[model samples]
Structures are given as C-alpha cells and as structure tokens.
Target: MAAVFATINNIAKPGCPTHCGINTVSYPFGIGRECSLDNSYSLTCNTSYEPPKLFPISSDDFEVYNISDSEVRVATLVSYRCYNQRGALGGIIKGFDLNLNKEYTFSVKNKFTVIGCDDYTLIGGADESYVSGGCFALCRKEQEVPNGECSGIGCCQASIPKGLRSYDLTLHTLLNHSDVLSFNECGYGFLVEEGSFKFGGAADLSTNYSEFVTRLESTVPIVLDWVIAPNKSCAIGVNICKGNSSCYDVEGGGYHCKCNNGYEGNPYLDPGCQG
Candidate 1:
C-alpha cells in the first residue's frame, strides 16, 4: 500500500502535535480539545498499536489514514458474502454512519464497488431524501472476468453522491455463488476512492478471505472533504483568511481559503502566502 504524506507548514495550532504516527494532524483537526477548532474535529491517538493508531473522536472504528489541507482519508471495511459447497456459510454486510458535523462531508470521488461472479450491492444514505447507488457484478465463468475492469462483468462500480455524509451497504447475489463456487466462493463490496483501486478479477475472489480483506483495507480508504463555517459563504461567514489569501465557496455549501496565485503557503496562517 502506498502512503500519502502531505507537505504542510504551520498547519497545526500553536503548541499542538502535528503528526500522529505517520498521519498528519493539521489545524481544524487535532488530537485534543484545545488543539482543534472544536470537539467534532478532535481525534484520538492510541499508542498501543506499535506505530500507534489515529481515529476520529466520533468514529473509533475508522482509523485515520491520511490528511491534507482540504481532505482526510480513513480506513474502511469491505462487505462480503461467503458460501460453502453445500450452502451459505457466513458473511458481513458492512455499514458506516459517519455522524459528521456540518463542517465535513463525504467526497464524490468515491465509488460503490462490487466484485464477484454473481453479486450486486445496494448503498443507502443516512436519510431517505439522499440518493442511493448500486453496483451489480456478474459473470458466467472466471475466464470471462477481465483484469482491472469494473464494467459489470465480474466487477462493477457506481458513483456515490457528492455530499453524502453517511451510508450503509447491503450485498445481494444472483445465485449465491452456487454456480461459480469452483473458482469464486465469495462476493465483495465496498466504497473506495475512485481511481485508487483496480479489480484483480478472479484472484480477488479467492477463498482466503482474511488475506484478501487485509490487502484491500491497506490499499483503499474513504475520502472526506472538510471546510470551515459550513452552509455559510465567505460573504456571510467570519473571515479566516490571512494576508495574500483568497476565500472561495465550495460546491456543497462551505467556504475554503487558498493562497493567491504565484504564492505558496498555508492560507489560514498568520503570515499567509509567502513570496
């Protein structure tokens, strides 16, 4: 798995820690009370896990993967259905409820993906008003499945909503893997960052569920977009932009600060953009 380490200067609040293990703890997101803008942005750093682990204060199940100026990535689970030769064995229908504050939202760059010989997954958002996405993956034989392809053969993908804050998944199968048990014994579904992963075709449907799951979690993560004073534009919200910085409204109802053209620096900092 490739790790992303963002280069940031003056990103953390004064006297606060900047890094949790290998993950960055930038401003607006911190490890302690006073360190962050508010409690909803707080994180937890557990040192018991060798290199230590970082998680959002709201969701201990999701470990912090990486953080940039406008986005944060976290580890996610894969929903799966397993079957034995005779009948259904057991499986998990992974679901997540972010409970995020208004300041944050799930980015649209994620795709609802499913992989199997005869499987389809449905994703429902937290509220009925929000739209849902589904993926259906079906194949007659292992030979028909294409490698790195997710176009409704052995693998399929669907785009998630732009401002989805929470969602749960349910996996359904056409034949319960009864017809494709010889080579594929399980079906898998997940929400992953678009372009971040590619299906391995038949090799990914292996019976060795533990190894396959571990590999997927390490390589793929859910992306979230963060903003300040959500639902309020720069015209109405309190200005947080520093010198040589400009404020712009994000599409989903929030505002962000950016360093002006030809300058590079943290836009929220005192010194702002540097020449």
Candidate 2:
C-alpha cells in the first residue's frame, strides 16, 4: 500500500498560485483554468474580500472554507420554519440543491439534524443508499428538552447514507408550535458536519429566530469528498501516478494515488516518492 500523507508538498501545477487567503489550494483543484486538472476543478479567487475569498468558478455564492487532497469544505444551507405568537406561520427557509457532478460526493461525516419541540423534517433526492428519510423532535414542555444532547426530546439527529451527492430538506411541524409556543416557536433543520454542533438545551428553543439560525450558518460547514478519474479504473484509465507511486481503486468508483512504501512525496508528481 502507498503511504498517504496530508503534508504532501508541491501540490499545485508549476507557476500556479498556491495560497488563496489563509488556505492552501492544492492540485486537482486550482485557482484558474491553466492550473487545475480540468474545468470542473477550476476555482476563483475573489480579491474583493479583505484576505481574498476562494470559490468554485461555477459557484460564487458558496465560499470555500477549506481544502485538502481528498476533501473540500464549504458553506452550506439551513432549512428552518418559525411560527408567530398567534401560531401563524411567520417565516420559512427551505433547503438547497447541490450538484457536484461525478467528481465529488457528500461525505458521510455529515448528519441530518432537526431541532424543535414539535417538528419533523424529511430529506429526499439523495443517493440510493439514502433516498428518503425523516427525523422528528417532540416535547410538550421546554423542561423536557435536554442540554448538550440530541436524543429526540427536542433535538434529533439521523445519519445519511454513503455516496450522498445531493439532497433536499422539507420541514414540518406537528402542531406548528401551537402547544409549545411559550418555550419553542420555531424549528431548525440542516445537514452539519458531525461533532461540530452542540444542542443548547431548552434555552435554544427561544423565539429569537435569526440569531439562532445565523449562528449555525457561521459555524457549521458541509464536507465534500473528491476523487480523480471518478469514472475510470486504474486498469482502464490513463496514468496519473508518477514515479514510485501506485494507483488504487476507491470503493464507490474512483481512484487515488499514493507513494510506495519507504518513500515520501507527492505521488502524482514526477520523482513521485523519496526514500
């Protein structure tokens, strides 16, 4: 097996800009057409921002948070619904559509979450392993909800299946906060990177809608796994590996290169590995 290290250096194409703001823009992903492996991997550096922001050339609205050899992190959307004091629908923010083509897939590291006293959320249009599912949170009183825990009391979490490329969310309320109005007036649902969220107990059930939703938007991110030659196998595709490098097939249909044993360096580059 080839040794895969996160510290592989000289990742970008020759003469291409490597740093975008605070993050390292690696190869297979680059800041421009001439640098990236292909147009699908092309990125844009927005100098309009203070430190300069990075975004996919295809999507300027989604800012790039971080990038690695195997994965990329970006800002995600939130689905929410809130009711006014009179039990009338006050606002609604639905889910979003993500189309990453064949080169990327949503990592399994994310979990679908729903937070509310009388809310239920359904997710659809994902990969086959997880085509459709829902999570529900119910509580008659604020005191019934727990702090720092998501066990379906007032907060519930569900696992998405492997190979999830895209999905949409639809939120529903059993009673529209009719019974839990005093303590809970809204419901929130989103796909978040696991271990990045913490339920704030009953206090989170407050009616201050924007603050609560904005907090999620600013802190949580969505993770996407990327691969090279996704549709071709090592035996049939053109070689991407260089000296001292070997190619291996990824489980769900893709390939990755790694440095041979007892060597170190970028496997995709010439003089691929060093002793």
Candidate 3:
C-alpha cells in the first residue's frame, strides 16, 4: 500500500517551507527532499537555532506543535512521580516516546490523563492488540478536587485505541503523596491534544519533581491520527487512487486517500486532486 497523503492541502508544491515561525508545512510533512512527498515525511527546519526549530527526522525530543488534515501536533515528554519527606518513592522519574511509524495513530481523540492526589497512570504499548489505557486519581480531600474535573477525583481520563503506534508514560503514587500531602506533592501524566487540557487546582501540582519537569512544555500537546495507506490490509484489485482520487478501508487498519467531487488537493500527490 504505502500511499497516505494529506499533504493536507494549502498547496505546498512549489518548494515547501510554508512558514516556520508559527509552524506550517503541508505536504507529506516536508522539510527536505524537495519538501517531501516521500522519504517517509522528512522534516527538519532547524534555522540554525534561537527560536527557529522544527523536528521530525524522528527524534530530538519531538517539538513541532500542530499540523492538521488528520492531525500531527507534538511536544512529547511528560511523566512524573514525586514524594519524599518519608512518603517514599521520592523525586524524579520521567518517560516519553511517540514513534509514529505505521503511518500514524495515537488519536482516539486523546485521553489517558492523570494528575495527582495519589496519581495512577500508565500509558500503553507493549502490544495488547494496539493500545492500552490507565487512570486512577483518588482524592480524599483538598476540597475533593473540582476545578476542571477529570472525573476520578484529583483528575483522570482514559480512552485511546484505534491503532496506536507507540506509547510511554508511567507515573504512580498511591499512598506516597500520603493523602494529598496538604495539596498534592507530585504526580502527573501525559497524552493530551484533545481540547488542549484543562484541570487546575491542587495548587497545579508542585512538590518539586525538578520543578514539575519544567512545566511539561506548557502542559502537553501530543495529538496524532493519520491515514492514507500503508497496508495493514487491502490488496485485491489495488486501485489505491490517483486522478479523481478515492479509496477506502480505514478504522484501525489502513487505506484512506480521498478527493473527488469538485476536487481538492493532495491525494497522494501528483496530478491527483485539484479544483
């Protein structure tokens, strides 16, 4: 299969580099190789530094922040666990990984959030069909947490399954924060990009887990969900789509590519869809 396209329209066929300061590069993601339509969506901008950086040759801590058409957002890195002063399981412990190899996944619209008060979180991916889930934020008091509501007390959320490619994040702390430690000692988790996150209180958590990992990049941003084709299935006649562009099959598998009626743009690139 291997077709997948979302050069996501905005016409990026002239030379690529559709903006950088605010991030925007529609055309199979792009950055080099004539602005990508291949090379597995290469991207690297790095304008020599000082506020000019985009990434995705696949790692460097993943930064980019938005890409749309099917989704792309990034930020990646946040997972905490803290408690000491005899509460045990003391300080530091952060983990994160996103991968995005099989085309893309990790966007069941996002969930799997967790915030302290005896936090309980464990993102998925060791293979269990595809994705996993976690949540267990218990609260005993601290006014019983109710600022933005994550639904397990201090905070919690879960739901992510479709065909995740990779996952990481593991933070746990049950009796360690020792019943909320006056106002949450430390315990955080990540995987957002669905409404951008909103749940504040418990003093926004800070018992010094290295200053809450420097604010988790302004609090999470990861959203991913892509499709167009890469063969998780589909073989038969093998049209795959071209000119008037069209294809089907997709749900947790592969095959997407569209653009018909009146036409649009990238449908796997070429002279496929226009208007």
Candidate 4:
C-alpha cells in the first residue's frame, strides 16, 4: 500500500508577533513597509496623540479609529442645514461614495436624533436609489419627554440600514415652524456613532443655538468589510505560499497564511517565517 499521509505534507503554525492590543493584523495587512502587501495595506499606530490615532495604510490626514480582520471603522463628517432671515435654505456637507463594485461597503447604524415640538428631518441619498426618511416630534409641553423613549410625541429616533455607501441629509419645516417658532425655530439632525448618544431635554432654542450649529461638523463611525478577491482560495492549485507555509480560507472567500510547524515570523513574507 502507498503512504497513508502522502498529500498532507505541511502543518499550520503561528508566525509574526502577537499581542497587537485589540487589533489582529494578519496576512495581507502589515504594520509597516516590511510586512504589508503594498503601501495601501499598511497601518500606523500613533502613540503621540491622546487617544492614540491610527493612520491609513499609506496616506496621512485620514485617521483610523479601529480595524479588524474583516472590518474597519473611521470617523467622517456630517452635513448641515441653515436658513436665512428671508427663509432661503442653504447647507454644507461632506460627500462619500460607497463603492460595492470596488469592494468597499458603508453602514449607518447610529443616529443623532433631534427632539422638539414640531420638527422634521430627512436623511437621504444612496446610489441611484433616492429614498428619504426622517422623524417628527410633537409635544404639548417640553416637560413630557421621559428618561428613555423615542415615540414621536416628545421624542423620535430612526435606525439606519447596513451596506449603505452614500448619504445626504436635509432639515426643513414640514408644517412651517409658525406654531412653535417661539421655543423651536429650526430643527436639527446629525450622524452620531452608535451607542455613544442619548436623548436629552428639548433644545433651549433661545441660547444662540451655536452648539447645535456645530452638529454639522460631527462624524458618524462606519464599518467596512474588505477581502483579497472572490472565488480565489490560496489552496486551490497554484503554490501561493512562498516557502514552508500553508493557506487558510477566510469567511469572505479569501485566504490568509500560517507557517509550517517549526517556523516563526510571517509566512506571507518573502522567506517563510524566519525560524
């Protein structure tokens, strides 16, 4: 009889320095030029900053907040809406594209909701599918808002969907702020990080409202999923691993690596994990 273990030539092993805090950067992702696939896949941990910023794989200015094997989260700007005394509407916003074709996906899981007497806000725009939705708050008095509730009477909140790429928000006076103009003149809207916000008392509309105006500068944290390619497994046929390494399939149809038993360092490197 032939050898029973003829095809099982290699066994998987651990490589590279572990303990990258909460993050786990495996193959295809590297800390610097020496371990990355290219400049675009690199990550920098900035210890100088107060919260410890994480820079993009190559460029600066685009600060990274969190990264994982399959997903990443970044801080982004939200749009604004303002009106003049003559009743003309004007606003400013940052535009983003969620290119699924390019393998980048966007999501809106958190909401910066506004609550007041007679308010209407709209969050819209995602590719060609233009759909707009918002919340309405009506109340007889300001003291009715309970500790935790968003029932549209004194408070309201909306949940955004997953896989959303682009978004533009607009605030307006659906019923014409004539009734509650004394206490609530302009409504508010913002894209806040999920789980980091809570509903407060009705905005004191007379306090210059400058703080509310700054909502436009806020950014919502979004998660993205990345992959090497579709239908391409490292174990299929070609010997993708450089030397004494093995390949393992990931959740999204991609493949990463492991060193063949006694080696160390990164198997994805030129020399199979330095023993």
Candidate 5:
C-alpha cells in the first residue's frame, strides 16, 4: 500500500487523533466521545486484532471496512447455497438488515447480483414494503453462457433504489438444482459497488465455487451519500466554523465549511485556513 498524505485539517477536535491506521476520522465521526459529532458517529477500534478493526455505532450488524468524506463501506456475509448431487440444502438463507440514519443514504450506483446455473434472488427492505431489486438466472448448459457476462445467464444483476436506508435479501432456486447439477450445484448472491467488480469465469459457475469464494472477499464495496444537517445553527454555536471560514447549508445531513480566499486547511478546525 502507498502512503497517502493526510490533508483536510481538523474536522474533529484539535487534540483528537484523526485516523485508525489508513482510515481517517473526521467531524460527525469519532473513535470516542471527545470528538464525535453525535451518538450516531461514534466508532470503536479493537487493538487486539492484528491489523486493528473498526466498528461503527451498529457494532453487531456489520464490520466497518473503510470510510470516506461522504461514504462508508462495511463488510457483511455472503448469501450462499450449496446443494448435494441430489439437490438437498444443508443450510439457511443469508443476507442483512440495514436501516441507516439520516446522515447516510445508499448510493444508486450499486447492483444486486446473483451467480449460479440456477439462481433466483430477491432483495427488498423493511418487511417487503420497499425493495431494492432482484434477479433470476437459469443457464440450461453452462457453456451456453459466456463468462463475465451478466446477461441473465449464469449471472444476473439489478439496480438498487436511491437513498435507500433499509435492505434485506432472500434466495430461491428452480429445479432445486436437479437439473444442471453437474458442474453447477450451488449458488451465490450479493450487492456490490458498481464497476468495482465483474462476473467470474466458467469455473465460477461450478459446484465447487462455494468453497472457492470462501478464499475471497464475500462482501463487496458500496457507496453511501452523506451530508450536513439543516437544523444546525452556527450562529448559536450548535455548529462551529473556525477562523477565516464560512458555513454552507446543504440538502443533506450537516452543514459544510469552507476556508476563505487566502487559506485552505479544514475550516471546521481552530486556527483554520492558514495561508
């Protein structure tokens, strides 16, 4: 990994540390109480783990993978199914429930994908009242479908809803894999950040693919859109913008700060925007 020079001055408090390894901590997001904007932004770092692990406010739900200015990516389990030659399943369905706060919204750039010779996946939200999307793929013969093509052959994909806060997924199959069970006996599905990955090769459509996936990343990267809040009032000090700085209210979560013409170094920090 290459070293990235950390810029964008103190979005958090002056004395607080701004990073957990390569991940940066900013205002509205803090490792502990001293710098956190609110309860929703508190994070925990487990030093016991070799590389150190970061957890979000929803600790039990998912593991925090990375965080950017307007987006945070988390790792979740993959929804996979393995069947015997006789088409018998030895496990239950897999997926997640995500009900995010106003600070973050799902980016519309993600796609829900399912992979297998026989796969039908449904992704929805909050008791099915709302849904992201789903896909159905049935490849009579693995050879009939080309590798890396998500054209509803061995792989399928669908668009996700914008600003979606809640999400869930379920898996279904046709012929229970009694057909096309030769090389393809199992199935896999996931939601991934668009353009980061593409469908796999012919070997990926095989019965052994389930075990192969375990050797790789189960979850994929995703984008989240965040913003500063409107109710925030810098006048009364509920929101703060330091020296030579000005605050701009946006349509999303929190107000944004910008350094004046002669300076640039994170306007939210004290002694901000030094030339």
Candidate 6:
C-alpha cells in the first residue's frame, strides 16, 4: 500500500538494469547493476500489476513494504497450531526463515510480536548463529484481555536483535483446552509489524469462534536494514561523482550521488541538473 519512488540524479554509478523495474527502486537498494554489489542484493520490481510489486533479490514470494536510509520491510507468512477433540495438535509447521548474511542484515528497529491466547511461540534462526526468544499468552476467559493492551495476558510481543539476516518461528500449546474446550480451542503465532497490533478483550477465547475464523488474511510485515559492505566505499578518492556532482557514502559501504543541492536531475548521466 506504500508508494514507491525512484532515485534522482543519475550519477552514472553502477545501478540495477531498467527492465528489472529500476523505475520503482529506492535508496539503500538498487537492481542488476554493480552498485547492487551482487545478484542477491538487487530488488525485483514486478510491473505485471497496476502499481507493481518490489521483491527482494533471491526471494520468490514476498512484497516489500518500505525502504529507508537504513531498513526495508517485507511481508511473510505466519505459523499456526490447533488441537482436536483427542487433545492432539491438528496442525504442523516446518518454520519460517529470512536468510540474511554478511551482505544484508535484518533490522533491530522492529519487534517480533504475536497475537492470541493459550499459545507459546518462539522466533529464532539468524544465519545459523542461533539466538532466539518468545512470549506466551493465556486467555482463560474472554474478559481477561482488556481492550487495546498487550500485557502478555491474551497477546504479547518480543524484541529481536539487530544484524540478524534470517529467522524461524514455532508455536506450541502449553495446556490442552479440553476443560474450556467449548470456549477456546486454538493458538496463533506470527511475526507482526511493530505498533501495528493492539490488544483487545474481544480477542479472548470464545466457544463460538473456530480456528478457521481466527486465521489472518495477510502475512505480518517485518523490516530489514541493508548497507553496502564496510570496506567497499566508492572507488576510494576517485571522485566517482564526476561533472559537478557530490558523492555520499552509503551506510555500510559504497556511495551515492547528489546534484550539489540547488541542482537536479541524474548526476550519473547527461544534463547534470541545470540551475
């Protein structure tokens, strides 16, 4: 739903190819060009639709939410668990992974949050480095969770560290709701966008509610931050920005161009911003 824009001042730096949907590219990210560092660093802007979708390089399914000077938000699937009459879980989940590396890192600015009652969830796995955490929520009765509050009662959230490239999610139920079986029978878990979820009493366990009815329609939004490799800034002192342009270092490494303020247009190409 966020609007996408392209970089101005074509400073002739290595950049993603035009057909690869370069028009929709933004700062901190590029497509198909040496400026992208490698293939995995590029973004794919699909134009099949009206506004088009921006997909991270190497990712088959995932829509980019927003890209800032330091981070990018993406949409990913959630994991769920349900218990049948016999008290056995009726669902199975392998887990979710983001797959980031030295070239890219997940943002610590956001948190991995979950919404639901009678559920225990874990979010882990960052490049096999293995640091993880989770939260549990118990809603014995519908009235326990107050409206607009997340106090680990009916809904809870946890924070993740910065520099992680990937992660996995697993959900489990601590106790069978056979006693309150008629009221609540399922648990849900997923990484949610920061500040996007709010606690409400209405979400508590309810007999009239079923697992199918609680399933979320869309995946949660997760954010990631990327930077050029450290030791790789613009051709060391070569003044990469030729012809009256200025070079600015990207967060991690490499550099971008600007038309020396007062000026406009692609600094990398042709007419360099006329006053």
lDDT of each: 0.78, 0.79, 0.69, 0.51, 0.68, 0.58
What tens digits encode model 4's per-residue C-alpha lDDT throughout 92-152?
3323333333234444555646555556676675685345667776665556645456667
Per-residue error (Å), model 5, residue 43: 1.5
**Best model number under lDDT:** 2
By TM-score, how accurate is candidate 4?
0.56
Strongest candidate by TM-score: 2
Which stretches of candidate 3 lie above 4 Å from their native place? 1-11, 18-51, 54-73, 76-134, 137-184, 187-189, 192-210, 213-215, 218-223, 227-248, 252-255, 258-267, 271-275
- Write the residue-wise lDDT of candidate 1 on 1-275 in tens digits: 44467554547777888877777676667888788878877998888876777887776767788777788887767877787787476544443444566777778888888888888877877763277778889888878888888899888988877788767776788777888888888788887889888888888876477777778887788888888888699887536887888998988687888888888877776777788
lDDT of 6 by residue, 1-275 (tens): 34334334223334445333333443335554354535655777777966666777677566775554445666655566566677676554334555664655666666665555668877777555578788887777666666787777766778877555677777777676554355566665666567755544454445223442233323346666565554466667325444666766765454555667677655544444466
Screening candidate 1 with a backbone cut-off below 3 angstroms (N, C-alpha, C), the clashing residue pairs are none
- Quantify how close model 2 is to the true structure by its C-alpha RMSD in Å: 3.9
lDDT of 6: 0.58
Q: For candidate 3, what's the RMSD?
A: 13.6
Q: Report the C-alpha displacement of residue 215, candidate 4, in angstroms.
A: 7.0
Ranking by TM-score: 2, 1, 5, 6, 4, 3
Deviation of model 5 at 157, angstroms: 1.7
For model 2, the stretches where C-alpha displacement exceeds 4 angstroms are 1-10, 126-130
| lDDT preference between candidates 3 and 5, better one | 3
Return the number of clashes found in candidate 4.
Answer: 2
lDDT (Cα, tens digit) per residue for candidate 2, span 75-178: 76678888888888876555566567688887899889999998998887655545888899999987778899999999999988778877878789887798
**Candidate 4 — which residues are off by over 4 angstroms?**
1-52, 55-63, 83-101, 108-125, 128-134, 137-140, 153-155, 204-210, 213-220, 230-275
Q: Write the per-residue lDDT of candidate 3 for residues 183-214, one digit (tens) a residue.
A: 77778787776677777756565445565555
At residue 227, candidate 2 shows an lDDT of 81
- Per-candidate clashes come to 0, 0, 0, 2, 6, 13
